[model samples]
Target: MSDLNRWMQKHNLCPENILYLYRSDRKTVLHRMDGGEAALYAPMHGVLSVLPEDQFLNISKGIAVNRSQIVNIGNDGVYTMSDGRTFQGRKRGLSSHRRLRMEIGLSDTKPRPMSMSLLEKCSLLDDMPLAFCVIELVFNEDGHGVDFIFRYCNAEMANIEGVPVEEMLDRSFYKVFPNGDKKWLVSYADVALNGTKHTLHDYSPEVDKYLTIHCYQPEPGYCACVLQANEP
Candidate 1:
């Protein structure tokens, strides 16, 4: 297992249990749902560096939070934690906070049943020959793009990546493929934020192959990419 995963397992830190991390004195303290705090013997930046990017939202230089633990966001850049503590972040953090709140709300909500015809029409995409996937651009609470989460992937996409669709769904793209090019990350974020289409040819170290990708936003905050494996 990776160091990050091992650290998470060592501390028993899971999404439902971890509240947030705060810098206190010379150490970084991890706050838990059970009303306990553990001081990590590392610099705040070091601790933040090891955290799973998709799971932690940095509210400020000294505060990082689990998006799921946020209860509500108030005007003037104040956020109420699930444990009822309020943290006022910088004014610049407000936009990112609101975006995170909206993303969480959408994910937690259940979609209404669609008409049978509509469902059938949507299913047609699954039969497409091209490898397809939808990615959610993750951001820090300060409004900077950090990483990406795989929201959906078709069987062809999974096969092309040599992973199961179930394994890719809702998992951090970086965690799965740590060697992914930074250029791809930039392109994904641009398409997600600007609603423009981008096409690129890149080599995937993970799959030991080259790939041609066309990326575009299906909606704000989400990117849909179609991949084609290129000749060696």
Candidate 2:
């Protein structure tokens, strides 16, 4: 057996994964892929050294990714590992992220024209911490006369709302709330959609509610829901 295989076997690494060490002033780690997994090619060349380390070690460990770096995981035990660039896991090596995805399964996928499944959109934004993904209702047109509408939301946003995201997407936002004010929804739309970014402190329409609002045009004709929770 080759030294690489012998080392990998000793380390409990998934098959098709290889470890290469580099000699540099500071120690570095490298992961090489043989199967569907992607190899970190460039950093491998500059790597100072390599060693068998757990993928859950200090955040800086090349194999140990920050929670933010993960995108999604499939039931087949494939993890969508990402660092701006995306990569996939082979088989049983996807345990950690697989569980996280399962916990948020209430946010399922729906067919969409953008070639993006609801799951993908949720997963893309959901990978971030709950604090990062913001949620809010959007309004159509310029006047307070318009009704509140369902707009875009992130994974964390779905969790906070306690409703399956498929139900939330594209629905009239005003319909969900029993006593939502049309004027406030319109003003929110004006600030968010009108290009002036605004922040609110006591913006809550109800008790125990504080929301920070920002606006951007993610696409033509649609206003992005940019909302963050305010602490009590």
Can you list the residue pairs that collide in candidate 2?
22-48, 22-49, 23-48, 24-48
Cα lDDT tens digits, model 1, 75-158, are 445665644466766677577766766767632222223335533543567868888888876644432234678876777987
Where's the lowest-lDDT run of ten residues in candidate 1?
A: 106-115
> Each model's C-alpha lDDT?
0.70, 0.41
lDDT of candidate 2 over 1-232, digit per residue (tens): 6554454456544422432222233433334432132222334323222333433222122334323323334444333332112233344444544565556441122212322453356456655655232233222221112343454556666555555656766666556655554435434443433343445444445323667655543432234545667776
Leading candidate by lDDT: 1
Candidate 1: segments with Cα more than 4 A from true spot: 1-122, 140-145
Listed per candidate, the RMSD to the true structure in angstroms reads 14.9, 17.8
Give residue 122's lDDT in candidate 1 (0 to 100).
34
